[model samples]
Target: MSRQKTESEVARTTGRLGPAERADNWRRLGSEEFDVVVIGGGVTGAGTALDAATRGLRVALVEARDLASGTSSRSSKLFHGGLRYLEQLEFSLVREALRERELMLTRLAPHLVKPVSFLYPLTHRFWERPYTAAGLFLYDTMGGARSVPGQKHLSRAGALRMVPALKRNALIGGIRYYDAQADDARHTMTVARTAARYGAVVMNSSQVTGFLREADRIAGVRVRDVETGEETEVRAQAVINATGVWTDELQRLSGGRGRFRVRASKGVHIVVPRDRIVAESGMILRTEKSVLFVIPWGNHWIVGTTDTDWNLDLAHPAATKADIDYILEHVNTVLATPLKHDDIEGVYAGLRPLLAGESEETSKLSREHAVARVAPGLVAIAGGKYTTYRVMAADAVDAISGDVAGRMAPSITDRVPLLGADGYHALVNQADQLAAEHGLHPYRIRHLLDRYGSEIHDVLALGDERPELLKPIPAAPNYLQAEVAYACSHEGALHLEDVLTRRTRISIEYAHRGIDCAEPVARLMAEVLGWDDARVAREIEVYTQRVDAERDSQLQPDDQAADAKRSAAPEAREKLTEPIS
Candidate 1:
């Protein structure tokens, strides 16, 4: 049985991904024949790396940019089984997702994934309540409820009491059911860190430039450092592509026909202050096209999302005026005080890699993932929700297990816990003691514990010699000054955008959209990244332009105009162009 971690053990847990790890991994990539080389640093790729490493396999994961800087981070942040998928009779998919959700909540990521309640309003009079109750009953009992509470039926008045923001006539009644949520970016980062802990060489800002061909079969990959422009050939027994929306694009780079195609469906979200919603639980409403979720985030409510076809730039999906207005108008239909443009604090858009099918509606596309060997030594996985990333990763690795080495172990991620998960519950009980020791508020210490778990001490150690690092940031007061430095020194943050956008939610959590604290954050990051005055100024300029471009894109009436405006901003690095098919 496992026991609580000692201070020395916690200190040496060493998922510390500083500049040294990057440099060392970069050197080691070319020197060894890795058992498996996983592409993409998103949740699936990271999870795959973790699974492979934990099974005594030599693994290396490469990302062209920062971890979860793509669809992974921009998801709805839910660990819930798809309630809507039940309507389509996708029982196996729902059951699989629910099982994974239970694992995340109770065993794997107790510190990160927490149970959240959602109010499903009944708009229709008679059969709606019974029908929804039946569905929620299945949802609650599908896999098992070892963590979150089951569904509870409530009257309209009771529902309004749960969510005071709902209008009087918004519903006849409602059923509040439990689901889990997490900071997708943080979860993905922790997965990468856990992989590192298990001896996986995980590095971001390393892009695969081309595939290495061994005559009639596949061999390895040639990759380039997006930071230093250094090229290296990493010989691996097999490679798994978990590039999400870029799945089709990466398949093209291999010069082969993938088993299937992936279609990009753009989903946009707007952030409003929590006080604006005045809700005890999140709200889920049905829209003509899809569904809208007014999710409860800390100190803010996240309203989203618009599902539509996107044919433009996949890297930076833009939220158009139509998308924003659509979300607002739909969510406003039941609001006690309808949200306005002024209430909007931030906006973001992400592309979902839905499996291309006969269904014209992107919302109807299957979230059930598919894995196939596009060529010898190459496996491609795509089309799954963020909640089921582990299953997807396990499947992807299993596809190549036979070819890579002899008698590989079966997927054991079901029993594996992420870094900081082991000692998390104990630390939560010691929040007050931790606060006193660290000279922080109990609430603040608790917050840090949730974010870092047992790794809180490691982060707190950084401020031991520098007291000023413990203070909160001026512009975005929710985050501390040390987080900026820590993002670089320990989180593989290479640019200012990496820190603001994904490392933290500041970019989309505030009205200023991290503009006020951009310079201070840049300065803090510069201290760790060794950015000169010129580089700092340039970093600030690029981030500011990106924000401006997003703002400009949101004013446009349609997708084409918005895409053009969003694409006008320069990329931080020269991303590899998709090879001609």
Candidate 2:
């Protein structure tokens, strides 16, 4: 169920980031002088743009690729306080993350973020329950967890009742606690859209080539349109480098040694069907290295995450055979029926930009974020968990006080809800009515509400001229044709890869990894993007090759071989160049 907003509320905040919007923003990027110019289009960069825009600062955000194309898109999709961090005695970090979790669940993104329960199995009978209970107590009470339910203890029989797929000898007891989850890519894109709604000029496929230096201080940046190979200059009082794994690389481009170096830690996750694991609630298992999670997706189970050091291509982090085997081997220990390679529907790898530490092990690295003014007018933010991105954005903006003129207003993003957040509850209650009006099922309407919230009206309005757009996609029936069109018209999705992979999860959620629906989706996009027959064929070819490369990479034995296989595919943004360190 979802709620509806008034027409004025929708019109006021639901500004489209369509093709025209990008063209207008590109003109402003070259002509307008801004107080802040943000590099990167991940969660942090988008959040910084929002934070600055809400403060009445003239802001522009430029991304090398589509929004959430990096680590932001390929995460575990949880807005959780790292439960394992509590064991590290990092109470402040856990509490801060929990607070942010609560904010997103209640006031911030109620439509996107939802409460999810996780059961922790107790192996050693006597001490394990109480020991885990104490940590969970701090988790619930330390942060204001008013909306979510508290912890509950269950016996072996109770545990088996909740999760029938778990092995009988796996645990003596279980403890259940609450956390939150969302579509990370969608949430990040919404934040960027919200920033645009607040008057920030946000454009994707626009890369920052180099820093514009005036004497010793940084003035702005040299921008390049990755699509057209044309260049322009953006003048600003302050520039924020929020490129996650690429932080050190971007800092070097500014001709300054960074105060801290960001090391890339690779994490891999595999997606399997829901029927493979018969669990009522998600599970948290203790591994030798770190904790493993079995998260619940719509009709699938997302299990994984192997943490290891990565030193290869930052753009395409490959998941090798060893990585997939590691996850399956660990998870199979407790499952009644073990999962195999044949059961895997999808596999993805992402790099975390951890601040380099003395510890050689990537798992031992800190999740705490740091902000440093690397130069007179340049600030770089790196490290940090996904849950604390708002706090990080605030700190990054605060560090630029010396660069910007006048006493800049403080960040008000804490109070500012993302574009689709407001009036979402009312829209949930009106889902049936919306479904009736839009000529779709109530379940489909509910799906749209979760993704677009009050902006569902804007998405549905596109189908008025073309009634066929309201139907479900041929191969990817989970999504509608309207969504494919909306990705180009409203969301800043330029390439077919952007639409299939980021804008929608067809790439990972389906068995064919979007190959089955490539041609259809490309043709749908062509209607909005003005692509001819040759262009449509080219888009499908590129996307198919990328998918084939990923599949081949996953079969490799190690990172080196996997990287070679994955990197063989051509980039969707052909004109974009990687910044040399």
Candidate 3:
């Protein structure tokens, strides 16, 4: 005979990542011997941890900074087959990514990943349609079965109806196709939390200083808590490095040259109000360099991506005036109303970890990933795009088979839905009831359902005692006060930057860029983390300086000047140091 679970019990059993959980995981890290230890808290690392844990392996994961703090959070936020890659004739890469996209849409993470449509504006008149149709045909069928709609061809007038913001001369016709997109930071953190639910010890703000070696073979890692400078040795039979752009840097710490090298390709994006572009669907246009995207974000349009090589400052890849100008110049050619600098609300830059090749152009590099056993017990995986993270993770863990003691199970992450995935559709169906119960609008309830899924109950439970938390933030009304508290209580947010930048995306969505609400957000976090008044003030000051530095960097003309300006801000994790050999 079983009893029904209380609301509090349900929240407790769902793997809350609070401060107590971190303290317990730290003790286990110092005390236990594991089958595998993964470094890097990006999507691949989080995915690798989930893959390892579900296979019944004892596993632990550690990140130097906040999860997705580096490249993962600063992405184009799409999970689709790289349509541009088809022009490069990378068929297998497209097929693999499409399959992953279908899985995320239909079976796994249905809450986080949603189907989005894009219009490929046809500049050429006659031959271009058939040529593009041929490519689209291959794209639609290559993924086997999909949940999204197939391609539809439209006349020039039809295209204008779909996107009235487009210039009359921009295209003769257009083709609309379906893809998927998600909040990348939220998805990556959910992957990590799902790993924790499956019994993988996970912690952020912990850096790998040096490799632990047993004679010639690698044994484990020496981890330092970047917040407190506490050191621990997490022993493991195998170690996997899934660091993206920093792959080579982490490989060097192992004192071994990796099987291949990784080069950093910088990509920059800018955000503007959604009303600036009067479109029913997103647009994809061609450039001499690469494809330009006008992605539809909530109340905003995300336009971007200049692909150029970047060598300086892997941690904070800065966007210069040239990069922003390049994007605006290309996108403005197609828009009816040209976008200027003043229309821009936010800017961000991220690096793609491409496998070093003979070509000097970063856009020419392969999108396929590579996994190699760099040392006896060490494996390194790099050079993959965001959509195919699960495949990259599986290949990485499979590379370390010999290091583990017993026969390891094959990767089961494809069948494993993320933490908030289950029961999401059912809750979405109950949005009206939820809104009535919580005294919120149905739109707000639907938003919470998308972000939290079935775990919306856990998030709402935080407001039970303090109903004031249910109200929206004064400046950033898109987010609730409960969400900020939930960042620390259930998402392992350590500092103010983690909440504004990655956890909730308040930084990039608003014109003030999280500066106006930094103190209020910090105060909300302090309630859960037990911070003093001085500590709250310090968090606000650090976050404000970061926003100021980013604004200053965007005015710089070149990468060197932009990097210097951006790097001047104090790191949130003050004790974090360079990787020691």
Candidate 4:
């Protein structure tokens, strides 16, 4: 049969690179010009690239490390309306976040983001119930709350029944509110990928070493490929600086005087087995300074978040015993069965790039983000929550449109579903059939669908070629062989840390820190990546040392001591000594 060519074919033939065509197109980067160059591979930068590309502007995104290597992947993993922001009377922030939440859950990355219920336990009976109810009532109506159900009030007895792990005396009642959650790393990567799908040049581990200046205006950047140690000069009419915590450093690189300084506030989270906390839903507890969340991940409960001023290392913020104790102390007061040191399976620390303010209270700092036109051709955006990244992205692209020569359209990301969102529903309906045809269990098919959505077909195809790839991983029985291969091929997972920490979440989900599974997983990855036995062994050893370093640091008394101990681990990337031959 003869194929009919349409306008879409015309568009494709007009020489545009889709997501699947990015690596090849990125090869032609230094040889051509870009309309807009984006710095930082965090949520905002990736979104900006997507926004600019979808608006029919030529775009390029460069990252110093892998995508979401910064604060984007280390977030609370919630797509919320900033319930705490409401207390601060930041109604606009809350509304904007909620609107973004609705977009993600409904039209955007539906598969990536899903609704989660949180139990806000009431410590005061009469005053709190009505007081909270009024606020929640208003919360329900604002910023398109249709994506999640409205808050439901529960009595003291009812609250205890829902969260049996909580102390019976801790709450007088409770209110259950709904918010969406997502795999932050996966979503950020998908955003970058989707942007590439719409004709953006997305490349990872490519650092913008220096800014290319044309007199007073910023023209482009000098990019160094971290993997190959190759340098390229990428020219663009406009450059967007979306480096979250490193905004000042990027500004300095661009020779632009930053209008504001971004201060890093360290937040630490501990992950423990879910069985230790027997609860029907997640809990939201108020601490002395800030709020704490007991979020439910797949096989574990994530209890956290100590907010303190951090002047230490930014790359890997170490969690001390004191930080863990602070979280455990406060949460233990509310829990019927207290958590111990041995109960924790994982500990992670991330810095919040709060817009610097005069206030001493880090918690009191604004969650509201800002975008600035730093130089003649440079746009910088910082200090935004993950939920409002799209807004930040839209604002960023808008800031640079005047500088872009060609006509640039407004951001239409609100209507744009992410890479795997379009056919997710149909894939869910077809899971059973897919499982039957593939000779795999229906449960496995469901797991793949939840993680990859419609992209499950791509994963299945990997195993389809080699039936051995369908079998379960040796130690980590939950993951399949094909997943390890898929992570490397499709997801751009270069290191073992990328696979364990972000891609599959084995770092936190497993009790042994993936020690037992590391070798097997590394071997599987080696087969796909063509890594020799020595290289595979080296990867495993490095990962093991990192796990050991983190464990040793967590057992330390103070942050300084813990950070010093964790810093003893090897560097994330090698220093540039010998250039690529």
C-alpha positional error of residue 30 in candidate 3 after TM-score superposition, expressed in Å: 0.5
lDDT of 4 by residue, 1-581 (tens): 98886422322332222223334644656887998999888899999998998999888888877788878888888998888888889999988888899989888888899898899999975698898888898889895358677888898888888899988889888999888888898899888878877777777767788888888888998888776678889999999989888888788777669988889998999899989999989988998899999998877899888898888777778888899999999999999999998898888888899899747888899988888888888988999899999998999999997889977787899998887787898888888899899998888888887688777877889876799889988777788988888877767676778788877878877778888889988988887677899888888888898899999898899889998988888744553221110
Off by over 4 Å in 1: 1-13, 574-581
By lDDT, the better pick of 1 and 4 is 1
Instruction: Give the per-residue lDDT of model 2 (tens digit) for 1-581.
Output: 87896332332256567777777788889999999999999999999999998898989999998899999999999999887898889889998998899899989899999988888989997888889899888878887355888899999999999999999999898998889999999999999999888888888999888999899999999999998888999999999999999998899899999999999999999999999999999999999999899999999989979999999999999999999999999999999999999999999999999999747888888899999998999999989988999999999999998999999899888899887889999999999998999889999999999999888888899899898999989889999999999999889889999988889999999989999999999999998888999989999999999999999999999999999999999988888897821
Estimate every model's Cα lDDT from 0 to 1: 0.88, 0.90, 0.91, 0.83
Residue pairs with clashing backbones, model 1: none
* Per-model TM-score on C-alpha atoms: 0.96, 0.97, 0.97, 0.94
* Tens digit of per-residue lDDT, candidate 1, span 1-581: 99997422332267767877778788889888898999999999999999998888999999988899989899888898898999999999999999999999888999999888899999898899888888888887896355778888999999999998999998988989888899999999999989988888888988888898887656888988888878999998898989988888889888899999999999999999988888899989999988899899988988999899998888889999999999989999999899998999999999898899748999998889999988888999999899999999889989997668688888899999888799899999999998999899999987887788887887888899988889988789888888888888888898888988888899989999988888999999888888899989988898999999999999999999999999999777655444310
Q: Which runs of model 4 end up more than 4 angstroms from their true locations?
A: 1-26, 143-145, 576-581
Residue 443 shift from truth in candidate 2, angstroms: 1.1
193, model 1: CA deviation in Å? 1.0
